[model samples]
Target: MKSNRRQFIKISTLGTGGLALGLSSMNLNGINAAYAANKNEAVSDEDLTPYPTYCEVCFWKCAAWTYVDKKGEIRKIIGNKEDPHCNGRLCPRGTGGIGMYHDEDRLKNPLIRETKEDGTQYYRDASWEEALDLIADKMGKIKKEHGPECVALFSHGTGGKLMGHLLKAYGSSNISAPSFAQCRGPREVAFTATFGEDVQSPERTDIRDTKCLVLIGSHIGENMHNGQIQEMSDAIDNGATI
Candidate 1:
């Protein structure tokens, strides 16, 4: 499965440059500058500190330098220039990490339910002990009644490591990720069959140094992938073919 996925991505890359160009143009700077500036100023590091980390916005897992305030709050996230993949550039989604972490509607605690009935859902704040106990109990019941094979686990990108461990420990073989079905599955499959090797990211394309970029369906100006998008802009500014 892994080999097939890699092949598909390789072929797609040859043609995707065009598609990226088109996508990048639509919404690249639609964000209001004043609003963005105000939001930045409002972030307080007293709540969290920007820890040097990485982002999982896409499959690349770009290295990031995060600003965590004195209070342990994450104030901002920017790509690490030292990282070979992103090189100090970040997509809008990654730049918006502060909003995600501070979102009021986000789940902050474990939830347990006695039944699946609507409105019967009662949430109680739980300690780690309580949460683990509940999970273990449920897993035991599930294994005894439905068998371990009945369970399926789905996750994506980098943070899936922990979930992968949990699934393996639970003895379920039904694990899947949407990367193949959603973004790069077709490209990967094609590349693997033809070449017998996967094209890991930070793919060989050195767009920053390229003389000409032929974009097929990719909207390069709009859908932002930090390094690629920035290179496209520089190419245009320097009058390189798009």
Candidate 2:
């Protein structure tokens, strides 16, 4: 309880990763033996607390339950049965999202760049107030030097919506998200040009009911498209030709 940050981080990282390593090294019989030996040490499913959440591993954001033991340690992640996107089964990435939580290298604090006497640059952890003040100061200077229109924003995910609004209110209309460059923008343009309609999120493809599932260069099952992959499987089971 009195451990320093480094000690706490080390203990947490090892504690989280130990299970993964143990399972990975064990075969079926070894796993069974290990489980039998530690049966009493294992937390019962009913005892573990379940928290409803959404997977942040990919854009699909499948709904899930994060199970935590009495000690507040993450036990596992499982898809919510009622979630339409997952249909009770999460993708591999979604199931493994706990790795992000226990990742040792993830940034947990703000850092500011500092230059040493040797002209070497390094990052030093800064307080939230310091970081915010520095950002405000820099933004003020930028606004004074160049018009706000010159400050273009590149964002992703739900947070991008708020960032876009902030940038626009700052007199900049140059807000862009990854969808514009990655796939959505081009796909929308092509679809509108050909079908005279724009494709929307939770796309209207209806892969599960389609007679023909065409793939030019797309890999629905191979990627993190959880819902689409499930639909593709359904289509194949129903005699749809790929």
Candidate 3:
């Protein structure tokens, strides 16, 4: 290696202007090996913190692992291998959840629209107190003019539970969700009409031990319920007919 460096210097001295070529040609394994050896030794377990969490982007709530670096920044997200629902596997949306924490454009505070005399309106950031006051004033006027039931809600699953409770407290029964009309709404309405009760989310049906399975309007395989998928696979393996 010493002789090789001396020869390279002699070549560079010959006006070849191949300094970059000399460096590129030189073996870097020794430096790389030393760096690799010290890499783990440089970081103690105390520097890295792994937090067990879950995805809230959807109703699934697949278990996840959030790794934090020594600087206290979230480094990565990994699916929890022990989670039976997803088995350490996450969907595309779940994998992109780190954006929820680190996105620069995310709303950090309230915003209100400021209108120009020319009929143009632009939004500007506002304080939480001012925003809540405006909301309360508007909602109070609506409740006085109409009824609380006139206030409707179209929300994602469970995310609007607090708002739902608030609406109910205000004597409003017009709360609704997209999940109702698209997925569970029709089933809930039918089930409630027949059974006199609301069906629970992710309906508890044991497909594994059952002898036969009858899917009416449901495409169970495409439903994306990991537990149900596992149970269905088990039922099929145990010779249960669909």
Candidate 4:
């Protein structure tokens, strides 16, 4: 009986080890199958032509130099010193913005989800024309049922202006944005209460000429508002207090 138990334990251990080995081998085979071709393709600066453009990562639109290889692969993005927003510097978000274009999993086409008879949903890629036509038909049906004001938009930053325009044209006064409510709302209220009007976006704080600055909760450098931080640096250089 002891001999039989020992044999059983040995067999169980060997079976577990064999299963792990098989799984590892299958994973390696799957990886090899997925990357059968060379996966180390790269573009160098020497093979790229640099073109000046503006970043859309944030509302700032920092001027940037984009380097595109002959095959139209973007190799890099750098700040253009001429642009005041960047002052020749880019934040981490701006520097990493290239991923938006080069990401392998980024959506390239519109998708329409079709509900299967069994309650499963499957999405199919669609052309721009087809997607737009479907949206228009649905929107028309909605407007007929309710009203144009039923549509509301919550947008962000400068890129959102086009959508705002479209919504307003479609008779949507119900638009709202939390970006305004949270990020800039307090500043607007403060300025309006004190000065009878609020300053434009960016607040245009003359940090370079200020004698003293008091920070409440704002981590200026860490907030990544490039222009303000640059001006704050200049103010620090000119011997301004915290």
Residue 62 C-alpha lDDT in model 4? 84
Maximum-lDDT candidate: 2
TM-score of each: 0.64, 0.75, 0.61, 0.69
Across 1-242, the per-residue lDDT of candidate 1 in tens digits comes to: 12232443454455456544543454334233323434554654455555788887566678998876554445568889897777887766677655555544446887665555564656667777899998899899999999987999788767677888888888897888876576567667756876776656765456766667787656654455656766655665555665
Give Cα-based local distance difference scores for all models.
0.65, 0.74, 0.67, 0.71
Per-residue lDDT for 105-142 in model 4, tens only? 45799999999999999999999999999998998888
Per residue, candidate 3 scores C-alpha lDDT tens digits across 143-225 of 99997888987777665898888889888888778766887788788878877887764455678797688888775545456
TM-score winner between candidates 1 and 4: 4
- Residue pairs with backbone overlap in model 4: none
lDDT for model 1, on a 0 to 1 scale?
0.65
Provide the lDDT at 20 for model 1.
Answer: 45
Ranking by lDDT: 2, 4, 3, 1
**lDDT tens readout by residue for model 2, 1-242:** 12233543454456446645754554335334433433446777898999999997678888999888787767778999898888889876677666556554447889999999999999999999999899888987898899898899999877888988888788899987866677778889887998899986556678889878678767565565778877876776667776
Q: Give model 2's clash tally.
A: 0
Off by over 4 Å in 3: 1-47, 185-242
Worst 10 residues of 2 by lDDT: 1-10
Candidate 2 ranges with C-alpha deviation above 4 Å: 1-40, 186-201
